[model samples]
Target: MGAFETLEPEDPRQVGRYRIVARLGSGGMGQVYLARSPGRRLLAVKVVRPELARDDEFRRRFAREVAAAKRVNGAFTAVVVDADPDGSPAWLATVYVPGVPLNEAVAAHGPWAARSVLALGAGLAEALEAIHAAGVVHRDLKPSNVLLAADGPRVIDFGISAAADASVLTRTGSVIGTPGFMSPEQLVGQPIGPASDVFALGSVLAYVATGVGPFGRGAPHALHYRAVHEQPDLAPLPPEVRDIVAACLAKQPHRRPALAALLDWLTTMDGSNEAPTLRLSEPGWMPDSIARLVREHTSAPLLHTPPPALPGTPPETPRPVPGTPASVRPSAASQPPAEPPGPTVAPEPKAHPAPAPAGEQHEPVPRPSVGETHSAEQRTDPATPSPGHPSGRRPRLSRRLVLLGLSGTALTAATVLIAWETRDSGTPSTDPAPEPGGKSSPDGAPGTRRWSFATGSGVDSSPSVAEGIVYVGSNDGKLYAVDAGTGRQRWAFPTDDHVGSSPTVANGVVYVGSQDTKVYAVDAITGRQRWAFPTTASVYSSPVVADGIVYVGSGVKLYAIEADTGKQRWASSLDGLAASTPMVVGGIVYAGTSFQLCAVDADTGKQRWAFPTSGGASSSAAVAGGVVYVAGWEGKLYAVEADTGKQRWTFSTSGRVYSSPTVADGVVYVGGMDHKLYAVGADTGKPRWTLSAGSEVSSSPTVADGVVYVGSTGGKLYAVKADTGELRWAFSAGAALISSPVVAHGVVYVGSRDKKLYAVYA
Candidate 1:
């Protein structure tokens, strides 16, 4: 975390509209204060000191700094949140850099791993790119000026050197430079450009990798002498990054790699002549020791309750800054994907039935044959019929047609599988979801509102949270990574069609299906496409990632795709559309099809067994205690043995069952068009309890902390007592609550027809 100090009596309790809470430190311009906005946002507000405020020239310079800071907006650099230049004491507030500075991190955690150094370089390069594009140069680039946040490294004190007039340094009558990090050109007082930052970046990275400056610490004059005339001590750097750091430390700036090329070089540290994508937000990016320090700052409540009074803590001011500079510090956390607790119900994916594709129109056929067969795409030869079809002569129809004829519909998690529980892997996330039950903010109490993210269209897709980012899809045909806490959009990846499939996060990649018939593997941190596996028809099925393989359904086939490569390992042809999200357990994948619940080999994609059923399988399946629990379009919840595909029990609901089942503590929970959420005995298939939602219950129920969190078409999210089916509370959304509610860290996330994703208390 960035350094913090107790507020002094001299510090203002209020800066403009910001409520000053504590002292950040002293900078050249004046004292820096940490403040909070009414919106609950923590910001760093820089106030001009009385001495500098009286200097008319300093006011102009401070004004320029505010404008310049506002112009340079980058993920790795501070973002100016608000500023007031003409006020009594001109102040500027920017997003806080909450993590520890590079110097402190190195000193505390020893040295970072090679990859961390590379990540730092990439982050710094990106910052430089943004700063230079805004026509500003951050001449003061040093270890103390770089903050290592959970998301990535952040560069601070940018554009301050440019904002300062040379006379200010003369007025101090003392040289002001962090000598170890100062570039040769700046040391010799030669005119500097953007490349000057590159030299400083090299020194910072060298410090991170070796825990010492390349120029060796000494007096400012000796440090400058070594920087301008000596070759940096690069022998200590790991070979993977040594050459690149050497290139950045080139005495002549022209020989250094451009910021653009610097990132390209960072990726190919192995000298393989091939650049592999590196995701900096991966779990292991920062060593466990240092990452814990960052997590503590990031995961803590957004604002620290300001002490009752300014304590005797020392100020964190730099020894000297010639011209006043803004000091802002805000913290961010690493987002870990929702690994839910207890049993979780998977929401039924939405089935699109109207206006079928011209070539894929439906035709009247026997009910059994119509519901249990493959799509026309798989039956390329008209003379041949899919053997999996109950009646070989039955015509092929899209999966949607089967749904319209049998189950009707439910989804945007009443639509996202990676939309629902263990959607992609089918393995239930345990314990983690309930951990936040205690000591959570009142905002997380039953039905309390937190935030909502508006999308281009309804967000039917379920959301996945990981590494401080929330991954969700929208009918808008874009997959958005949003800040789970702030509801701010981080990035959006465009798709050709609606992305109704819920996202599955594994390793450092996010996998999901699109109606466009492609399953994409994306870099979780960067939102860049790593690979796309093409399919034959609309892929309404969400993906389950396991053991380097991505298992998903598209049309009549279950595909085992190489997670890293877009290559298909094998495709298992089903007699009917395998539209349900697949769940893999014990090397066997359990998935529902229009005609039956199919068991396939996880490795070879070979069909292990298929259990025949009437109508079709409309919802995804859940497995627990050696049995698979799946809901049928015919309103039957079937409990079948996972290994043999033999039925153990069947519980019939009042109406069609589109909501997937969640098995926890020997109880199977599911929703139905009958407007009820039911808890059935997993072994006996006997109804334990049922809560009438007052509207159709399409979204699946997620059980955590002895409660069931579910959504209804009536647009309300309900928290019910798991044991007795007692309703604790309900929160109304703007539209249909068709999206299955997902619980993570005491918060419930669900999408709605109102084109928004709501985060409420669980």
Candidate 2:
């Protein structure tokens, strides 16, 4: 029975040691109760399904989950105040948040306005970043898991799936997760990490803005299949939101921008800081652009569930209420089809013939060569069935076989087609120019605006500007070089895997790393491989050049090589991995490792000094004013004396700050997982100004022509005044941007998760 079913046998007064005050809700897991602890603190307690509690593996997993939950801090997630996973009938309890789930909020109140949606999205991203940092993943994240608290949305049901132990049971032997919201890998039972939550958040945000999931609905398995193989339907959403969601739903989990990326994108959306407009005006008040979107989305065969009712509040019959104005008529087209019982199952599906083998499905009948083809008129004879059937009618199938196929097999193309038709509303045409004048640069500045060329993928790597040209590699596996002034492609070289490491150009050679586990030096002008260096693991660190030496790290080893010869000079083993590029300054090669900051001699690759850090460092170090500034995976930004390697000061953030720091004019600028770009005093590490992006900020900062430019996972590239970190201008991209921004000539160049490189001018 659904959670809406009324149950009244004097409603249990107590469960275990807690006194039940009221009903919270119910699901497959059993009923939830609003209870109070001995201390009189209100809590939401979920009773486990009887069958699940009896399973040994399930119980063990639940215990493990409880252990994990105990490790989590309550700042970002709903705190687990108490639980009894070992109870005769297991149950867990968390603080009660008095508000409707986001799903219900949207259903009862209409889709959130863009700014409100952005706020919600940003909050979720922040929560995910925290969860991931704590080494946990919220496998099931939908609008229902988000509580719209008075101050901000609170992430609830944390670690619930882990409590289930083994994956949740689904039809067809599939593992867990909501069909429409699960990431591709999660659908296939692959271990998921933070990226999975990022994907789920993308779906939730899409639903918030467009009243539909990113993927159109169908059977659970079908949604799973599409999630792994097909792109999301984002036509109804604004490009700002659509791009980030698309990035989150990338087929390859690693390709999806991390939670930080998504947070940054939402934080940078225009008008995100504005208060949500409350008064529901006319439907027409939603922009004509969006109304056009409504018309298109309404055309699709999407399905949605009714808004959930408040805890302890039974569903009442619909009746016109006095005092509040009520519409005498339906204000819109008929509501979408009611959601089915389980996302995994579909109701009464139509049958379709199985497709032939892949190669034989469409042979084009082996058309004759153009010159020897028959006359057009003769070739256009009336169509007819082939000899086997003679008639077009299909062969009659036995009733038993048909029943079996309908009951047990995957849905056919015909069923998918039906779902597609229903789910497809006309998508608004947002394939327009992003903004007037692309990113620009001015002359005589330390950083000049250069020509920005499209990379067709996320440019997580850094750009190397040399020889009047700039070279960089992309997640798409293509290394591109463009004329610094003209923005024309010089040439591009393709590699075997994601080219996330930036190219280092020197002595006619361009050095780059690839996810393929190899570093290659290519001809700067010709884009032809000159030499290839294989590594035991993938290379994500950009190369730093100094004094005829090229220093780079792959996995956990830092290699110093001869710049012109492409031969190794020395290799040093480090305590942990380094994912950021290294900075070579004053004969000391400074690079960040997962757990420490190491300074090595440029020539011998011998460690000069090392500073131990409790948290891993994922970003490279910035050197200026005799200080080294770097951020870590642990949410702290540190300033170290460049010469002595002694830590000067550290500033803490609510979320991880993985983006590398940019030092300019006595201030250091960096993006944080906390969804804010911070300007800290270069000497003391004190925050000067913080411009909250409302999403993760993973992209490194670039200061050019007096403006500091950076991109956020939230899909926006912001230009702020270097001195005050004041907002100057921002350009929206199609997806999360992990790529560091490049200011050259007069244009700002950055790559986004939307699989497109963007260039905007201020």
Candidate 3:
């Protein structure tokens, strides 16, 4: 079969951020699409059938299977990058391995030579070892799941697999595996384990070695009967491999040799005095005909343009404004009308409006982009201070002279203002000119505290800033909005349960999740609850709002809800509890559970893929340039492909990692329980430097103006150079600090277990 087929019109143009290029194939579970990331990395995206997604039991099973598959990171296995199990049409994405299935290869070229068969056995055994190590049992290990790559064989498709430690999704006495390759125990609906996989392995090897099944051709029932009661016809197999295959085909599970033992046997099949490891490093590991077939299959184009959209599904169009003439309406093919011929005039800032009542909707005001200027004639509130002025006073100037000057040099002054703003906006400012040495500037001399805000309980939630207001959640069951300049609370919204999730502010709304199993959207200015969506369990994962959707995790489910109305768009069940905050970028939401980091379609709630780690992951992900940087609780930081979930590299630490990672200027900064902070290369995962802290470093790091700011469990906050990890300054808060730091207007804001929020100088 061809590696890829042309996509039909009904195929999605894009799933999450990945663009669909072609159709890989369709199966009972889903249709697989050849897709590409924003960085042009190829991925195999599988969109599950709608019926399967709606089945609650099936969704749970799929989630568990995806998690287990991600944990299997073997050289000879396809890696899962992302997945969403609770979406309307659940999906998953895996690394696009370019190889032909073993069945196809063997069918086209006949049986493989003894050496090739031995090598294949070793590679597949190693893959099985990895899978079993992750507490997973691949119940169905047929030839179709084995791909003959140039380097070795890759095992794919863990759909029917189950994690040993997880709850069983299948019913007792249910026959779940394929009939032809299933072990005798599996055929009788008995408890299956890793040994079951060994039996299937033998069947596959027998077929590859002699071009016939060990049980011989028959109906599925007949084959089942033979597998259970009759011995395999191994007479056609070569003597060199016959004994090993016979051992694997042992009727009893315990009688079958372990994968390790089998691999050792395969390595010495040549009978050399020196034991040769079956690394498949030697040329000619594959038969010449099979190798040629693999080359031809892999050499085909990885991606192809999908067919055009089908009829009746017109392309997107901008909505027409009320009272606009039909003749003047802009069409999809037409350009907007040109602006009037004149120099672009800056618009005036509008007056602040009164706050709306609770649950009332309000139109959001448009804000100017960076470098955009306000008109000189714009009205200013006399009682309010301007951005640079702190005294709430206006400077007097000669109106006539200013007007004359503006009229004379309007164009030149506007050009200069735009250029200056553009240049400075590109780089984060260490200190603005107006507050060069003011107390508000974090660059003040060491040992100075700018301000502190105290609450009812310790603050673990990170602060988010918007329009001079700082919004954060507290363990006291309250969401507080404080004045960023004065450190005084403006308002606090109370919840029934403790609030550990950090608040996210967007479009005048503050979204947060609480332990009461609810996600709340409140007015950013008034702290009045607008709406709340309830989940089945407690919510600890922080909420992220993007494209009018609010995403948060409650227990094992991640939900996407309408930001304005609080109506659920979709909910994806994970394999374990999701306590890690999600990071959304390029239409994908990256979140973690106890064992895996999952990438989900932000729009559809479908999973794109998942990446397994050595331990549970509570750390939020950082995405940049199509790569994801995340820390696992196992004391390792991983650089994973944003498109394929394949591990690029890993950096091990001496302690566990609960702190989220921050990526800035090509470096990733993270903290660990080992009482140290690390700076690693974003692309290579190579350590640049490390800084020892007084205690465990669980607080996530933040970067601003080329400086890294992070807090430690020792209650010390340190500011270091982003590129070198050299300490610039450290402040003692007299208690442990678990809350992450946030930088705004040159000041660093973090909370400590001392029950106080500290604004420290950078």
Candidate 4:
């Protein structure tokens, strides 16, 4: 809790140029040691795992990220001092903060009062402002990463951070960071920026104010899912702070207030006519209990003797210093002869292992993979619907005329069935049908609908919904746009080869890739080709558009094309074939190849960094909180750093992984050829649950409304609870299902090898 523990025999005596004095703590990556520099300055040296040290790519990335981290300097942040990524064990050193972690402090002394929490928020916001100014994003900003010093809070752990301009280090499609405090975009694998940190700050401040995470504590996946789609529980927060915290927790990153803006808000929390100030140095800023604990921990004896006192200085005494509170006095003997007045230690806190902070470190509760049900008690909030419930609020009736637009008898029959089911239950229907052309329900859940669109060949591309239309591609070389409320095709545009890449609709244009070595931009409404960009080889990587640029990978190169003109902007070479789709965020483009995961500048297509993998990666990358989630064909799922391409952790599946991972809450969901669907931890890569399927599973999972919907090669579409992996229901497609599932309007849409696209109730 104090960042120092007795060094065990197994711990190394030294790492790089530092002598290890004690252990700080262990994370998923490696052990952090409290060590002293050659000059006797305290440092926290994080030694890399042996396996990671042996990885040449990891070592290279580690060095780069360390260099980037060293550039970060701020009052509320621990400064990186040195590192030796090429060392035998590899290590990085940061200024050792002599304070208790926020989690530990909160656990021992209870939640901080409103005034202290406001000060904490202001300091943290300033820290984020500095971090972002350095072009860095502290992806993991949680209570545990914060140190509560006498002066203020210090944010630590750049283990999963990245520079804004640096290449991402994470594997494609992996999620990183603790779940309870992650931002909505991080949970959904969206591009993260400084705004993401603001969201995390909101979560942390909420925890400090309410003693629990804003999203609550439970299965990480559930928490992450809630972060993405549900409103945080601010009911316990004080009225003065609730609105600001709520604004910070907005689902859209752009909606969240900037750090500077947030700092301004925090300064006026007391409703005082004078501007509220963050005075950490002032007495009573921190609660008395926490101050005593800080004093006790810092006053603990040093592992080694301090340098002699200056010649003319009066003999140092264990007395309270002016401006320092009586409850938090410095230890005279622990101070260095020439150093400035600061918190001093007495002796190590009896080597007592502190209790793990709530929601900090605990073995994940393994959930059953098969059928399990949640009772009323399991769902205590009526506002939070139970799993399988389409809407959280009670159902309501909508105008029946909304169904009149059905284009086929099949949809009419399905609507009739829905009416019959509601009537037969003998319970008044409280759920309303979707608005005539809306894609989502009142509660943001997909509405129930039944429709089928048959193509000339199997449809492997997942459906993308826009403007009441569903766009999908098929092996028959055609992109089809079908009515959302019915199964009628609005238009079909033919390509030269199979359309395997999912369509991305933006600005009235549909962008997709084909096996024919071409990327096409077609008008969404007319299905007319707007423009086409040709590559040297097949383009299986889906195109992502940002700022009028289209990023896609084909064969051995990643290309940036003008979205409107289809003219090539730039192209960067890759180590192997581009096997997955490209993700563009924060001016960076991430793509997976047969042999590596690469990041490039979105505008110039200049290579930023690439992390080599043991095998080819066909799984598309998901970027969240400075981590990339990607799977190798060799059965391993990896979480890599986004800025420097450093490997954070990996989870091995029994079979090959071709299905891309979808992250929700704190869980990464993906299917494997081992005929199983797995729920893996986004931060630690630990397994939460696994559900066995009848055959190989190559379909990526989609999570919504607390349910995970995925298809298997065994021709079945499964609906499982996102929190527990419990099977809710299954639908047979009569053929192998290779397409990923999409949920909209309470309907699950997936393609089957039988040449049909089916839409059924979620």
Candidate 5:
């Protein structure tokens, strides 16, 4: 039986004013039923599970939750139409919006292009501002709570964090907040505030663009470890959105810009004036779902009609008939010869001849020799029969000729049948190609191989593709810029040490860091050094540019440098070293180091707030919606509230996760020392899927065009289907590939431990 059925027996068609129409879906605590009110209004009712109803403490907390939810204005949230927390079957009801969840929309529709993303950001920011205006904090702000209503966006399930904020409220011991979505303070059972909600908002934004949440998935322990340490991946986001999201996701509560300010910034964005729309037809999650459907329904083929042949043409050749041999006819020399009726000239046999009886014996026909026939023809007039071979006596009794003719006719029929059967046996081949500006490629075919490129040695760093250029750093101490379309080397900047850091290009400048203890700003067009900033330790962190400042990390300090001058404007010292890069949004810079993640002032690099991690952080941080996701070397993923540095929840991995976390759709993608790639829910931190590779993964990941590209210490790079965590393809190098892959045009580019740069094409 299904889990929901075991918890609540399917019975009474109605509850209170709602008449249950159907069960839309179920979750750990209850079932969500699509129902209609007595007034005939659509609503979604959530009835608590039987087991959870037995908890008196849960009941009391739930009542409080209901009361708090009722206090909020419904304009920015789902209208709480009714509730019966004290009833035999505790339940809550809200107006049902026809639109899908933010997660579902991104998964089914795909990442919103610039406009939609901005509008979404602005709307969510406004919602958060309203929520903050009220006295309550939405501790569990994930993609699920933000529904994409047709009119606008609606935030739901507010104030429930207090009911089962920790595992203590239920027998399952699984908290209410999702691991990747919860803020750092919340994960540690700390007090949550409005800033925490902003953090979650950041995460929501990340998922919309990339399909994954900020922190990756894992068990509770692993998740907690990450919450205490590590940074979320934001490389998959577009340059403009990344800046805003990163700031909102700052680990420090004070560092994050106020929701009111965030809303204004988002509104003024280039695309915010228009509604959000996807540049590509579908988001990263659509292809994965379609692929799953294809595998399940293999019995039926997706067929297409063949295009019309030239103006006038023979109909298509029919398939061969079954049980017929598809081979050439027997030689004419072995067949019986027939006497000429009138003239000596003879006709050639057809390509297909009738088949002879399998076991039948045929009589041989006697005929004049070739020389005799020729002489007879010469002696006769053109149209007259020869005297020796009169029409009445010439070949009237040649049984062999008659039998041979019959056999040839049979052979011809058999040949036709075989052709028909052969064609039927093969897979159907379509003639028309795919349409342009559609889901399919230019040729209209699905699942076509895409192009890939290799840049720099030692792919331990993630790659950034933008403005027609693919930028990446190599262990060989060189940062290379390659053509996004052709994969040809456009420029290579050699550094003093290994370039294990990725590159970020904005405007006309390329920003990258190297182990040489320096961050370089170079001309995107000329590859000339525009400026460089020296650090106290090796620089492995990537760079993020926002407003007029460039945010990066080195050792234990997060620095904000001038975009045009590369001069350090401010620096914040941290408790531990930072390998992960910082995400800049608004005026805040979010980053992690060792066992702590924090937010710094983007303009002055002043410490705003710091949240300690149980383990050190190695992965980069990602911001979206309003949450900050950071993965730790200790095998934990943390979701810290962007504005307050509060812990929302924690999810754990089987092993340490060095690879940065990338967020897309509603899932989080992170590679671990376990050699596994994981997808976790952005709101609940629940496991969606996991895939195993051959070795440890140190390289960060990036999502583009529906594929997740990551490299491992196993010396291989993999392109995985984001939804299913299935490896679509892998490219093996002679040495470990620590560098992440970048996608642009139709190609993916990465560097390996080997000195060579390789390019793979569709």
Candidate 6:
């Protein structure tokens, strides 16, 4: 889920002194853009939201914090490159750290191993020591705020959290933090300090060691209660670090262990009292899985290389970065080629880049086309950085990452929940990710690749098929429509940020949600946005269209809107964020919330009943045979009565149940992190059969004609016997396949982390 999208009309061409190049993503604070300084240096520029800029008190506090933020120079922290606190619209620029966010990494891959979590803790503890030394309290230190750079995890946005805590916008006494990660002091409005960060550190470690948060997921108020009165659930955590995490989560700030103590425990893991500074570069510093990520993330550009060219096609031309010299740009290869065959993925010899322009400034910035990247020699660095690295000195990052526009996802406790998602129905996703698999050509083994369509970045958002066209969203902030038969682009609709919520099509209209905090309704045929419904938070829940209404969830509310008008029909509040795609069956919209599974009336948008799950419901409810089956982060699958929201039985899995279930012939089919696809009795919640996939199975399974089709992070999609859970055949996508498979007309369609959507022969 990494790549840049071209700038838009609404985007500023220049923010402060940097000339904007491309749009990265949006947050609660404001928009983040990739830009270049006049000296031709790259910078991640974050423009603050106007409302926040208008607050005079906020300006004063922000300036103070920004100045203090400058003094924080830590090995495991992002550098604060620059700031414009007094500008008409405040902005901040820092050397960009191109890596995955900790939450996204954990959810994509799975929890870190015990030792890896310990190593991570040490780095964060050291980072805290530096920030606290600067007298800056990281009020909102959570998974999203921590970026897993190549060398180590970098704690970001530490400067802005304290300013947000003091802001009048959050209301005088309301503290700012994520629901599950906030310390009790922040929840109770007690004075906060560095100790609060330690508490959050504990929560982060628990989440990293075990996928679920320590206190469980729920609404803000519920989290507050649990933080104050309930004990963090550490049952699933590895024994090695359980005590440390428990101490960190202590309700009383004074009772929490100091950073030095935590560091001491970490350094002495091998029984030595010596506290040696940690380096991810050191062997065993992190798991092999994460180490691979560190190598690729730090050594390569955030954008991936383009798919290899096919024979008889135009020569490959790397897209050039705006304002870069034209010599490295396209020449004859720039010409468009004839339409490609219906299905072809041939390899072309690699071509060397042209010479740079005379007296060029530094290296020319190559801007490849969407879904394209430079050659091997070009990807040697993490793009151009202002001397940023996790080894020692960190290139400073601006305000909070989004300073002003920290999308609600990263700003406060306003958002969360995930795996991967697809069109309205089926399961939602959660896990660990590593693109250990390679891109498969048509001539490759297990040659079932009918064709593959690549997007700008990763393809976690599943594909939605409609009228011979497959509609999919990308982390590149665009929704793409491709020819189902030819694998050719039909049209593309761009938003301000990434589009993770899958698309649902009905009545010639495509409905989707974006991290840009808007639900867009576009012409299904033209890819033109018809209207956008704005929300106060990002829309992680995919939209479901039924009758004339579009049912979707954003933040903590489930909304029903007029399909044609883009106007809200009604909004129903929930206990927490809406991460699950809505499932509409029989006039009822069933959705999973942070703490419960909710069934809402399709027309009135009123909750009929909310069945509270022991853990957060990570997947959407699947309704069949009068039963609504759902998966929970607590590692259990629940069989609840569709009509009454009462649990019939709960079957526990050895791992988290992020995959949604599919029922056929009185058996419920589900997959879990245990690397098995389970077939259980629909009525009994007892196992009928299980098929080990050899890797985590986060992709929900689709059942068709006595066969179950499911994708795994192992980079393969397996077709298994519906009755016996025996494998029939498997197709490899060469990357993790978190997107659920869709089967129709004898073809199985799946999206992969490789940034391609594959049409396989079923």
Per TM-score, the best of the predicted structures is: 6
- TM-score ranking, best first: 6, 4, 3, 2, 1, 5
- Which is better, 5 or 6, measured by TM-score? 6
Cα lDDT of model 1 by residue, 561-642, tens digit: 7666667888876645565666656687776765567888877777898775444465666666678777765577888898
* Residue 246 CA displacement from its true place in model 4, Å: 0.9
In model 3, what is the error at residue 28, expressed in angstroms? 24
Tens digit per residue, CA lDDT, model 6, 112-131: 88878887888889899999
Give Cα distance to truth, residue 486, candidate 1, Å. 0.8
TM-score of 4: 0.46
Per-residue CA lDDT of model 4 for 1-762, tens digit only, reads: 432355555677767767776665554346777677778887877777675577776677677777778878888888888888888888878887777777767866777788888888888888888778877888778776787788887887763476666545554212335556778666444578888888889988888888778876422222443576568999999876788889989989899998877888887784332222337655676889988887887786655622334777432222222221111111110010000000000000011111111222111222222342211111011222111100000000000000000000000000000000000112222333323332333343332336667899766565665566777777688888877666677788888766656665556666777756688777766677777778765444555555666666654567777667777888876655543556554677666655567777776777888776554454666555677777775678888897898999999998656666666676777777677889998899999999987666666676666787777666677889888989887776646666666666566777766688777677
Candidate 4 — which residues are off by over 4 angstroms? 1-3, 172-175, 270-278, 305-762
**Where's the lowest-lDDT run of ten residues in candidate 3?**
412-421
C-alpha lDDT of residue 573 in model 5:
57
Query: Alpha carbon lDDT of residue 200, candidate 3?
Result: 88
Give all candidates' CA lDDT scores: 0.59, 0.53, 0.60, 0.59, 0.50, 0.60
Score candidate 5 by TM-score against the native. 0.42
Q: Candidate 2 regions off by >4 Å?
A: 1-432, 435-456
Could you give candidate 2's per-residue lDDT for residues 1-762 as a string of tens digits?
A: 012222255455566777665454544344676666677676677776565677666677776676666566644467666778899778877776554455545665566667656766776777776666655677777766765544456677665645323333221110235547878766444667777878888888888888767765332223443576578888988766777777877888899887665666667773444322221122332334434433443343211222334788653322221111100100110111111100000011111222111221111122222343211110000111000000000010000000000000000000000010011123232322353243444442222323346666555444544455656666577778765545667677887766656554445566666656667766665566766667645555655445555566655567776545557778875544543456556677666655567787766778888765434454566666667766655567788887888889998877655566666566767677667888888777888999977566666666655677766656677778877777776665666655565544455556555555555554
Q: Per-candidate TM vs. native?
A: 0.45, 0.46, 0.46, 0.46, 0.42, 0.49
Worst 10 residues of 1 by lDDT: 333-342
Better of 3 and 4 by lDDT: 3
lDDT of 5: 0.50
lDDT, candidate 5, 1-762, per-residue tens: 011111123443566866665454444345666566766776767777665577677787677767766666745576667899988799888766544455544645566665566666776776666655555576667765665543456776664444323324332222345435666666544566777777777777777777666543321222333444556778888887888888877777788788877877776674334322221122331234433332333322211122233666422222222211101110100000010000000011111111111221122212222332111011111221111110000001000000000000000000000000000122222322212222223441223323334444434344554556656665566777665544456777777765645565555566676656678776655566767788755554555555556666555466766667666677765544444555554456666554456777666667787765544444445554566676754577777787888888778988656555656665666666666777777667788888777666555555555566666655666778877888776665545555454444445555554554434331
Count of clashes, each model: 33, 41, 9, 34, 100, 37
